[model samples]
Target: MISVLFFVLLGAMLGAALGYASQVFKVESNPLVEQIEALMPGGQCGQCGEAGCRQAAEAMVRGALSPAGCPLGGANLTQQVAELLGVSVTIADADIQWVATIDESLCSGCGRCYKACPFDAIVGATKQMHTVIRDVCTGCKLCTQVCPQQCLTTVALPPDSRSWFWPKPQTAAA
Candidate 1:
């Protein structure tokens, strides 16, 4: 009983010290980086030339990267980032985003594409046909590149409820 009481007292003291240290050593972070990271799609697919969304957000805040850099977020995200940074941007006609699709007829139940997906967006068991989870896919084309049977292909993601945006109002020519 005496040993148990001693251990409990030690644990309590250590916990208190840890709590105090955390408060004293708290690290400050840029609010703009946090906000930009929040606006990202959180795919972490490395398609934007950064290792992850947080790194990309830091780059954006540093002015080393453009707001239109994220392909996964598409035009809507570009507009949001531009607005946040107080910059004007034009969404190019070539800014179309693509998503991977498996041609069911060509699929041989191989799992290569599933293994290649960094986002875990492809699902299937070994020797079973794999399917792409549309919402989670970042269209990095990694799966398409690694498919042994060439069953995976990329197609333009059509505008849906979540992705659809209102077009900028047209102005008459001066």
Candidate 2:
């Protein structure tokens, strides 16, 4: 009975100590990282050399990366990130937006492009002409590189009503 009582006391003491430690040493996520990530395009594209936008945000907060690290986000996003991080940085030149177009005449329907696309943008059956869902394509060019017939080509996406956005309001010249 005494041994049982001692064990119960020891367990309770350890539990209390752990609970106190957890409260005292609670780790908090950096708000800067969250802000940086929120400003990003959330493309999950690795053009920034990071795994995803969240990772890039973390790197930027940790000073391991620059605000212009995201190629997909472009100048506007860089500017936003810079402002959030309280750093002055030159806006990166925007990259041309490309959309995958499959030439039905050249497509062999081997399904290579379908499998290569990370976004599931390509739709078709084996031995049938494959079509690219333009709306879903991120234009990472992963499909173009994997097409054995070179049927997949990236075309510059023209701005449509959906792509258009109002320009940011400029501040008064000092």
Candidate 3:
């Protein structure tokens, strides 16, 4: 009985300490919801199936919506947000692949395009011919504008790199 009583007291003390620590270190919450609402493209494009980005973000917190609903947020930003929410997310079916293609023949290897790529998909040393690693490319088009020689081109996703998952077919009619 003494041992049990001692254990219970210790557990209560630990719980109280943790609760106090949490109150002391508590962080401001819902920053993403507010920020996303503010950053919304405001085209009022209800691509997220919600009335707008604000509604979609609320639904996301409620676990009733997917981040894919926000047409303006895109997959990259949405994925980062979903990670914070501890929720599963749907990948956006974005425009067909737009990987940056550098023409080695024309590439001056100035490294501007590599610096412009947001996904770090391009790699090379200074004065060395930089190449885009197609798989990692997010195709935000930032690199195309920065290429000094104007050698960048976006290509459609190859048949193989492209993913196609068919919806489950309905059973035969009775």
TM-scores for candidates 1 onward, in order = 0.87, 0.65, 0.49
Which candidate's TM-score is highest? 1
Clash totals for all models, in order? Answer: 0, 0, 1
Tens-place lDDT per residue, model 2, 1-174, is 999999999999999999999999999999988888887767576778999889999999888998878766655677788888889985323445678999999888999899888778899999998998988887788788988898889898776655444555679999
Question: Candidate 2 overall Cα lDDT vs. reference?
Answer: 0.81
The segments of candidate 1 whose C-alpha lies over 4 angstroms from its true place after superposition are 160-174
Q: Clashes in model 2: which pairs?
A: none
lDDT of 1 by residue, 1-174 (tens): 999999999999999999999999999999989999999988678889999999999998888999998888888889899898888888775666678999988998878888888888899998887899988887889899988888899998877766666667889999
How far out, in Å, is residue 34 in model 2? 3.1
How much lDDT does each candidate structure score? 0.87, 0.81, 0.69
TM-score pick, better of 2 and 3: 2
What is the full ranking by lDDT, best candidate first?
1, 2, 3
| lDDT for 50 (candidate 1) | 97
Question: In candidate 3, what residue range of length 10 has the lowest lDDT sum?
Answer: 159-168
Top lDDT hit: 1
Question: For model 1, how many clashes?
Answer: 0
